[model samples]
Target: MADFNYAFISLVLLLPLALLIFLYLIVRPRSVNIPLKNRHVFITGGSSGIGLALAHQAASEGARVSILARSLKKLEEAKDAVRLSTGIDVAVFAADVRDYDAISKAVDEAGPIDVLVVNQGVFVPQELAEQDMDEVKFMLDVNLLGAFHMIKAALPTMKNRVDRRPASIALMSSQAGQVGVYGYTAYSASKFGLRGLAEALQQEVIGDNIHISLIFPPDTDTPGLVEEEKRRPELTNIIAAGGGRMKAELVAKKALNGIKSGSFIIPCNFEGALLSVATAGLSPQRSFLMAFLEVVTAGIIRIVGLCFQWVWYDSIQKWHAQKKRT
Candidate 1:
């Protein structure tokens, strides 16, 4: 009985990954006929993290890739890294996601793109009461406004491409956008907006052969992750209790496959994917509130455990070691 139960759960879990992979395999030649080969793939915030990882993936898949970010040095490094990994030459452009003109310039420089991935974002943790105006504004500008500028400039060419294969757009969002979390008011809002944009764009472009995918990745292990942990306040212990962080490679693979599959909401994490599919079927009002409450509640519980461990466990462990020596 136990074995049967285990198998059932395993199927429940692996079923989704298999299904997504199958979707990608099924759509590879039928929908796009190109498999991203010799295609111009443009990625925002591609200097590092998942964006860079996706650049590497696209390179390996035979795509001529270009990445845009704000740091020239980091962009060079990322280009080198992708070159090392995939033996492909990738172009790096320094452009701020928030600037439409700058993004337009970068796009022109890269030329027509076959696949555009908007993966740039910012996470500002602030409470509504404290209203860290600077952080909140920066988050809105980078996470929301930046996405808008990139999409607006890329849509024209994406829709009217003269290439053999139709173009596709992938927007990188997060589980936080799928649900609300404490101290992530602005971040959540920006992601939710991206979610909305992808949905509307997908609908409006019906029969145009232009695909749009909204990706919701959970907290992933990346360079930005270390910074988040270092800056994390004691209160953030609450959110730290879930599964270990996701990897950039895993999330990037999912994003690429999701785009191929024309998935409406691509969850970057397994748990996130399950929840996304489940909630996407429900009313938006109920789904958002429920998801929000779950994030907040889990965060609080984890933080409480962290506070207790800090208060009592460290000293106890040290004392136990001394007693053992004595």
Candidate 2:
């Protein structure tokens, strides 16, 4: 009797599975592994910190690297350091990312780019009320509009590469980009703009066989972070307390790995992973299994995210109360 209904039962069960498989095949990003070897990898903010570390890694991996920054002296220093470490001479360009003309000239001279990393950013942590308007404008210009200028300048050449191999554009976003935190009003606004930019850019470039990666790195041990710590407000520190700091080399490695894999969202730590899953709204995902995880765990992650928000709010209230007493 059961055997008689086997075909009907199988059809019912397998149809849903088949539909899911079809969706996975179509919706998933065109999977790609962008090869860095013997390819041009152009990095903005390459003079120091995570950008320099990434430049070093790409060079060591046999990539033809070009480093760009506003300061020519720092660019020269980065070139020397990369040469000393990898024995590969990387091209250096001095161009402020804010200036589209300067960026366009640099991209034209660097030749066709196989991978473009927009890693330049600036942050001045202060409550929105107390922060100067100029500081907000500076962060918005450098962190948000600066990336726009670089992408606009580089995209035409990157799309027309003779080799026609897959290319990558990696945006260096912070955890603040994923979620707004205390005293990061202006900074978070600028960084959060990157997520929207990355998501839309992916849709525009997928036809050109280009992939976009948005990297969310927690506080990393870098010269910039050292400087940022001196001005961090007490509330900012409290809000950022638990997320651990990672070394620049590790962050660079993570960023490169994600870039090569055509990953859409690259998270650098445990908290970052949790944050990614929680904020996985409508972002392009190349990995089928990761997409499944994101879909299945959405409800659970929402609960956990709420719990985290509650804790954060509790901290804020307690800190404010303690401050008022003093």
Q: In TM-score terms, which candidate is top?
A: 2
Per-residue lDDT over 50-150 for candidate 2, one digit per residue giving the tens place of the 0 to 100 score: 99999999999999999999999999999999999989999999999989999999999999899999999888999999999999999999999999999
lDDT of each: 0.74, 0.91
How badly does each model clash, as a count of residue pairs? 2, 0
* TM-score: model 1 vs. ground truth: 0.75
User: For model 1, how does the per-residue alpha-carbon lDDT over 1-326 read when each residue is reduced to its tens digit?
Assistant: 99999999999989766755554454321333225888899999898899989998988988899999999999999988988877888998998987889999888878888888989887756566876788888988998889889988887777777864667888888877875665678888988888778767766764567777778887787888777777653444354333236889999998888776656567766567545644463212212333444343555655654664575455546656878999
TM-score to native of every candidate shown = 0.75, 0.93
Q: Which portions of model 2 miss their true places by more than 4 Å?
A: 1-23
lDDT of 1: 0.74
Clashing pairs in 1: 238-299, 238-303
